[model samples]
Target chain A: MDWVSHAQAELRGAGYRPGAAARLVLEHLDREDCCRGAQEIFDALSTGGTKVGLASVYRMLERLDERGLVQRIDLGDGIVRYEAARDAGHHHHLVCGACGKVEPFADRRLERAIEAVEERSGYSVVAHDVVLRGACANCRD
Target chain B: MDWVSHAQAELRGAGYRPGAAARLVLEHLDREDCCRGAQEIFDALSTGGTKVGLASVYRMLERLDERGLVQRIDLGDGIVRYEAARDAGHHHHLVCGACGKVEPFADRRLERAIEAVEERSGYSVVAHDVVLRGACANCRD
Candidate 1:
């Protein structure tokens, strides 16, 4: 996991100021290894001294997405969510609508089908996000 | 194709007034096949002197959706789109983003995967809609 220093460097490369807010988001969400919304990130970063607004969180996250440091997911909600792009492996998500629990999984077959569509359609497929949403284990019981 | 009278009967059965505006929208979108959005349906009825407000179009369409007379699709666009649901079997769409054209296809492999997930998780999968968007051949050329 990229710690605070490395995350700050990433922000600097992405042309954002190496501020405390940006570093806090990168490190915390990168460590979580799952998708999260901006409000959740703000909660994680809130401290007595550190000041971060939800709007700033959204702006910083959008900047990270532009820099390829993170990916934004729509998740059928009006608000967009983010997951870190560290290690750069392809994967998809399983979301629990009941509890909002998210599980990330790597599915090769689905990826191949997407690639096939790209090749056949002549659309240079930049990125694809596959999501499967349903009730999770505990939610069923 | 369900004409105005039958649609009026269906609506009346559900206690909806068979108002001219509602009937206009119903007739405009009630193709033997294909779905139609509120804007398209409104424009189609406008030429015929139907005094349908766009808000009424939206509300009537939402009511149709609730009554199983129509289906709404995301299309990845936040704008809610309505489609007539007569003979509306389960299917998915291949949308050409560049041309705004849509084609429908059915793949049992996809259905099986949904079934597999439902069976494995014991979650009663009600329904699903898959949309694949890309630039079409003309758009590429």
Candidate 2:
């Protein structure tokens, strides 16, 4: 079958009943290799003739997140963005406080610090989010 | 001459109009040294007989955040929590994925990593938020 069907089957194997919204959202995320807000996903689905409710999109996103099928990024701009999990490597975000742009970034030192925290705190770090807020280059110019 | 007044003065100095909601929100934040969600702030204000809408709390929090008078913490859940910026030293948060408990933490290594990111990215790096999510001790049991 297709990638979406395979994902749905995998989720089913993991005891998650993947619905149409989940399939649609996962397909959209797969097509666009970037983070997307719930409203953005809803709008894109609607525009693409797959009408889905914002609440359903949110619910599906949360389920997908719980199942490790998606990665949720919170940039602290009152918006939560999601991207499909492919290998689910750890990353962070650089947010432009002036223009509201989000850029994904990976830092070795930051990862090392997280490992240090995990070693000291006795808390297994399942996931982490780091967002640095500042003016982007364009905004600085 | 109190903390709220000082925050208002600072906001005014930064060309921000300190509204009644902002003042009240600042007062609540100052009184409580923990992160608070918008609804929690609104309920507290309501219980204290100082009527304020949830939207107003959110707006004031955003304004206070912009003025560096408040720190917004995103625990990767849907809600964004706010705390008054005292001395405004940088810190991070450890969040319980199961119980939604948030614990504030400071790490010199994490701070150094942020400084490294600022040096490398050339972004002013006005602020940074780090959320480490895992099961707390209680939840781990």
Interface RMSD of each: 3.4, 1.2
Off by over 4 Å in 1: A1-18, A47-49, A86-106, A131-141, B1-18, B31-49, B67-69, B75-77, B86-108, B131-141
What tens digits encode model 1's per-residue C-alpha lDDT throughout A5-118? 665687777666866666666667767767888888888778535678878888878787766677666666555688877655556666777887767666555556555655
What does DockQ give for each predicted structure?
A: 0.27, 0.67
Candidate 1 structure quality by residue, lDDT tens digits, B68-124: 677666565555576776554666666776777766655655556645555654443
lDDT of 2 by residue, B1-141 (tens): 667988889888988787887778888998997899999999999999998888888888878887788888877667878888877555778888888777878889878988898878867778888888898888886
Which portions of model 2 miss their true places by more than 4 Å? A1-6, A16-22, A49-56, B1-5, B15-24, B49-59
Q: Give the TM-score of candidate 1.
A: 0.69
Report candidate 1's interface RMSD in Å: 3.4
The DockQ-based CAPRI class assigned to model 2 is: medium
Mind giving the per-residue lDDT tens digits that candidate 2 earns over A6-29?
678878898878777778887898
- Checking candidate 2 for backbone clashes, the offending pairs are none
Q: Please name the candidate that would achieve the greatest TM-score relative to the true structure.
A: 2
Against the hidden true structure, what lDDT does model 2 obtain? Answer: 0.82
lDDT agreement with native, every candidate: 0.67, 0.82
